[model samples]
Target: MNLPEILADLQLILEEYQSRLDHYSDQVFMLSPEIGCWSMAEVYSHVFGTCLMQQKAMEMCMQGQGMEGSAGLNEMGDKLFALGHFPPGKYEAPEALKSRVQNIHKEDAKALATKLLSRIKSVQSEDILNANEDQRMEHPRLGFLNASQWVHFMLIHTKHHLNQLDRIERKFSMC
Candidate 1:
């Protein structure tokens, strides 16, 4: 999607998150609803943390600080871009990343979301829009992605997590 479209979608998703936050009681925000599941706060923490990392990669690529002569997006990246979303499945966080989302308070999650939305809005320069595809960062699984792709990935990633948020809310309501 184009920058404007991406920005609009991102804003909508962030607003949705904020709306949920507005309605959640402290107990509901912190409840997991089941074993081995993330609380709503943890989910927000994880999404914002990942988006921040992706945003940094996009900035690096736009500034020509990405890996020189890097091979572009791999097959999976191509598929994901073509699909415009992640394929349906459960994805596990790496062991190192698991702890980062733990015990996140609602206020901390709100702060992270605010910071991320601000950073995302700041990347609308012409340089970023026309960033050189060769200046790319390696996604741990999706291979090298340039600035534009990184932006798109952030959108897809956030949208993908909305389902998780819905599920958590549903489970909480049932309890």
Candidate 2:
């Protein structure tokens, strides 16, 4: 796909996510239905830890500084990917990450969502073209996810969880 197409799709995804989350900002954290269920805050945090960072890693690889790979987990995530899922391997996410998410506040979630969109938008057009999906790189945690697929993961996964967040938010009569 052309760089513009990829970037535009990513931008749309971010905008949609932010719009949905904004609607829930006025709701109480305790009442946000996804309460014990990976709240909106947790989902945003996971998008950063799991997908956004991976996109950056792939970008780095295109610059000749390939990411550190982990065949063990890569193999596992890939297997799950083939089955239409991503496995949460041991090294897939550190304990610190889970801890961070569990403690995240609503305000923090808004801030994180802002930061993620900003960073995602900051990726240059040239960089997108440079980081072709055909280019392979080692991933720090779970190895390779062709450059294109890495970005796709970020978009698709974020959209998927955002849908979940919508369901949770719907439980409230915030309107």
Candidate 3:
């Protein structure tokens, strides 16, 4: 997609997430309904980590000065999008990433959301978007993904957890 289109979508996604989180009370932000469920703050923290990782990968690829294959060329990457959403199941996040969503204060969540938004904006330049698509980084599940696909992952990942946030909110309200 073109730079303007991508940037606009990214902005919208980021703003929507930020606005939703901003409206929550501290109790709601930190309340996990049960042993496995994540509170809204936890969800934000997790999405922040994923977005940060993707941003770093894209920056590295852009710095390498190569633009190769497009995103959907990889079978695994294609399958991820083809599913139209994150798969339904409990996948374990790596230990390092698991801590991301824990022990977060409401203020911390806001800061993280802002940081994520800034990271998205940082990659909006034409040069970065036009960078070689061939360069890739290892994604734990999807294998190697190019810079563009990494950006796509950032968008999709947030949306996925945002779904979780909705469920968490609904369930927490009943408690």
Q: In model 1, where do residues sit more than 4 Å from their true spots? A: none
Lowest-sum lDDT 10-residue window in model 1 = 94-103
Candidate 2, after superposition: displacement of residue 100 in Å?
A: 3.7
Candidate 3: tens digits of C-alpha lDDT, residues 29-90: 88777887777777887877678877888787777733445342466567876775678876
The superposed Cα distance between candidate 1 and the true structure at residue 52, in angstroms, equals 0.8
Residue-level lDDT of model 2, residues 48-98, one tens digit each, is 556556766657656656544423236655665565434332223466456
Preferred candidate (TM-score higher): 1 or 2: 1
Model 1 lDDT tens row, 55-151: 9999999989998788787898899999999888889877766767766778887888788878776667476778887899989878898988888
Ranking by lDDT: 1, 3, 2
Ranking by TM-score: 1, 3, 2
Decide which is better by lDDT, 1 or 3: 1
Number of the top-ranking candidate, with TM-score as the measure: 1
What is candidate 2's CA lDDT for residue 131?
A: 65
Error of 3 at 50 (Å): 1.6
User: What ranges in model 3 sit over 4 Å off?
Assistant: 1-4, 65-75
Best by lDDT: 1
